[model samples]
Target: MSNVQDAIVNAKDKLPNVTPTPPGFHPEASVHELKSRLLWGEPGLSIIDVRDHDAYNQCRIRGAMNMPMDRLPGGAEFSLQKDRDIYVYGANSGDTSQAVQMLREAGFRRVAELKGGLEAWREIDGPLEGVDSMDDPGPDAYNVFARLQAFNEEKAKEKRMK
Candidate 1:
């Protein structure tokens, strides 16, 4: 058999369960967990910001949609599916929890409160978009390897500090 075929066979034997497993969907998720999902290019989940219009326009998790608290349930009902995995946040933990409760009451089964909101995401340097996040994406924006390396460094720094 070819060397490539042999390598594949060996690899399969060594790691029989190897597969793409995105971060777990839970009632609450950490910023790192969400970041890991984005880095792996998983798009099965949604991030919703429950903050008001101005707050959302200022900054938010890159792909997050703004669904302000007052109208959040109605907006989400109109736009999102009941079983969709959703990571929600707001101006604070209280708001985040409240949004999660609202979505659950609205019959959405898979909803999670993203603990620490935008501040936690920014602490780990997650990609963001909005007028307040207008700074250049830097020279390495498209360099996946460099971004991964930076992520690793941040993780290690976090570990060392703790």
Candidate 2:
């Protein structure tokens, strides 16, 4: 093989596994898996919290949209395409499983239960909303524009360093 071809092969081999993992349904997924997927920034996926309103308002996986169990089916049908990759959770594992089942039965094929829900996510230091009660706020914690700008700058710096 030419030098360029060999280098391309080597680089592809070293690429992060998560980047090559196509979005799809799994019966369950750990917080770390979901975190990697989010950091990889593939679009076409969503995190859903099926917990009640108050609980969802208190804490949840950042970027999660709430659709309490009672309203889940209708809500999902209204907003989501059947093939979109969806990660769902509730108050606990059991609830999470139930929510996943509900979504699957509703004709949504790519639905995975988020294992361990919010607590597991917290254990992994995953980004969260409604975390004001738990820790001191960072300067751009709730500032979307500021956070986006900082993220963009950091990514640019990393690219330059690379």
Candidate 3:
């Protein structure tokens, strides 16, 4: 089967029996809500930040444990109970989706991604730490622009060659 078809089958098999959350369920909560939920003790909720260690150390929702996508196989050792809510986030949805897939494959029942990621959090003036200065552009925005530029440049180069 084609990779895309395989991916569709795999994704369908991985989704929990429970109804998935509608898109944009919590339109306002930032990364701060994620932190609060973890800190204030949602008995079964656990937060996983899928960003790399460097970015994680620079700043992340307090108490969020790093579970970078590349390292998620190790998460099986954590023995996460299938019953709990597993909240995953990255600099944005792209990374979050990958992590959610991993968690689902591992049989997590309730998984949710933080909407808009850290950028949305900051936009709404959400709480943050280890961010001594706000001079740095967000990684999510930068990555999107960089990818677009690369694609455009490649297309331009192809046109010139043609």
TM-score of structure candidate 2: 0.69
**lDDT string, candidate 3, 4-91, tens digits:** 7557645743565363211111212344445334323345566677888888878765556788888884673375676566677787
Query: lDDT of each prediction vs. the true structure?
Result: 0.80, 0.74, 0.58
Candidate 3 ranges beyond 4 A from true positions = 1-41, 76-79, 131-162
Candidate 1, pairs of clashing residues: none
Question: How big is the positional error of residue 47 in model 1, measured in Å on the Cα after superposition?
Answer: 0.8
Q: What local lDDT does model 2 show for residue 147? A: 46
What's the TM for model 3?
A: 0.54
Q: Residue 56's C-alpha lDDT in candidate 1?
A: 96
Number of backbone-clashing residue pairs for each candidate, in the order shown? 0, 0, 0
Which residue pairs overlap in candidate 3's backbone?
A: none
Candidate with top TM-score is 1
Q: What is candidate 1's lDDT per residue for 1-162, written digit by digit as tens? A: 346755764564345223433345557778876786676567788999999999999999999999999997999999999988899999999999999999999999878899788999999788889999964678986797876765555444534544
Descending-TM-score candidate ranking: 1, 2, 3
Residue-wise lDDT of candidate 2 within 76-153, one digit each (tens)?
999999988899989988888888898989999778888788888888677888745365447765675664554444
Candidate 3 overall lDDT versus native: 0.58
Candidate achieving higher TM-score, 1 or 3: 1
Clashes of 3: 0
